[model samples]
Target: DAGVTQSPTHLIKTRGQQVTLRCSPKSGHDTVSWYQQALGQGPQFIFQYYEEEERQRGNFPDRFSGHQFPNYSSELNVNALLLGDSALYLCASSFWQGYQPQHFGDGTRLSIL
Candidate 1:
């Protein structure tokens, strides 16, 4: 079975630019979570989508937003990008039920030039 998959394995953008990262969850998964991992830092939760609605979000500012499709695929959008926004954006998926383990993708490496 395939795990989560992300597109545009690598990307580059300039400050004030906008970018969108895509993700396709593993089979049988219904929830998707987005995270941002900076160099030498742990993954920081960005937000989660379930039932096509944003269920939760982290401390990230409004510049970060996302969407979940009925097929359980997802997209993470970052607007007005900043140098600090350069990081590995991860996509994780799992059952929406309690205590299910999440499976993550290799992530998209975003560089702000």
Candidate 2:
């Protein structure tokens, strides 16, 4: 039983570029959520996907987007990246219920230069 997995554990990009990060959810999980964690700060919710549709969103800008595939894997995309976007991008998954605790993957550390 594998837990959630995220690829390209680290990334380097320049301003105005776009980047995509991938995630594979744990077994028996159906919902995927993206979060951004700045240095020394807690995670900030970006968005969530369930059943191939976006089910909830946070206060992030439209440049932040995500997709949930039929197999429960997910991807997070950021466009027009800014230097401030440098942070850890995390992917979390849980059962479709509202109160379930989410399981997180080792995040992708994104650095914008």
Candidate 3:
């Protein structure tokens, strides 16, 4: 089966612009998590979704939002983007069972100007 997939591998946005990145989880996965990775830094957890609801969130501000559909695909939406928001957005998916390891997609590279 195909692994997780992310869209628009690269993007450029001006400050204050809004952007949405998409992801599709691997087959049979029921949970999706989003992360932001700045240059040279490890991925920082943003949020997680299961059963179409957000189950957890990190320290990110409200400007960062997301949704998961019944099909297990997901989207990460960022509003009023800032230069600091430029980073690689990663999506990982796994079963909702306890301690399941996540499978990640090739991240979307977002650049703010």
Candidate 4:
């Protein structure tokens, strides 16, 4: 009965530092996707992972990477972070190639200080 969950509800970091965000899939979900949302903007797809492999990616640069564990949990990593990177990072979980509805976590608010 668990839903999607993300860690470090809030985070503060400096430009050029690396950060890792984590997520746990909702019950019965097998795919995990990451998104970034800036103030006043809609979420932008970052990438998605399934079966321990990246099945799809957005226009984001290589600096954005992720991993899907055997248990369906996921981790998103941002390297050489920049001020523009400060935003709400969201994780969503879905099943069957995203044909089913996705459940999202509350999101992690990241601030570049």
Q: Residue-wise lDDT of candidate 2 within 25-63, one digit each (tens)?
A: 989999999999999999999999999999999999999
**In model 1, what lDDT does residue 79 have?**
98
Q: Rate the local accuracy (lDDT) of all candidates.
A: 0.98, 0.95, 0.98, 0.95
Model 3, CA-based lDDT: 0.98
Please estimate how well model 4 matches the true structure, expressed as its whole-model Cα lDDT.
0.95
Candidate 2 lDDT at 19 equals: 98
| lDDT digits (tens) for residues 18-108 of candidate 3 | 9999999999999999999999999999999999999999999999999999899999999999999999999999999999999999999
Superposed by TM-score, candidate 1 places the C-alpha of residue 31 at a distance from the truth, in angstroms, of 0.2
Native-to-model Cα distance after best TM-score fit, residue 12 in candidate 4, in Å: 0.2
Clashing pairs in 3: none
lDDT (C-alpha) at residue 82 in model 2: 99
Expressed as tens digits, the lDDT of each residue in 1-112 for candidate 4 is 9899999999999999999999999988999999999999999999999999999999999999999999999999999999999999999999955368778999999999
Clashes of each: 0, 0, 0, 0
The list of candidate 2 runs beyond 4 A from truth reads none
Error of 3 at 54 (Å): 0.5
What is the model-wide C-alpha lDDT for candidate 1? 0.98
Winner by TM-score between candidate 2 and candidate 1: 1
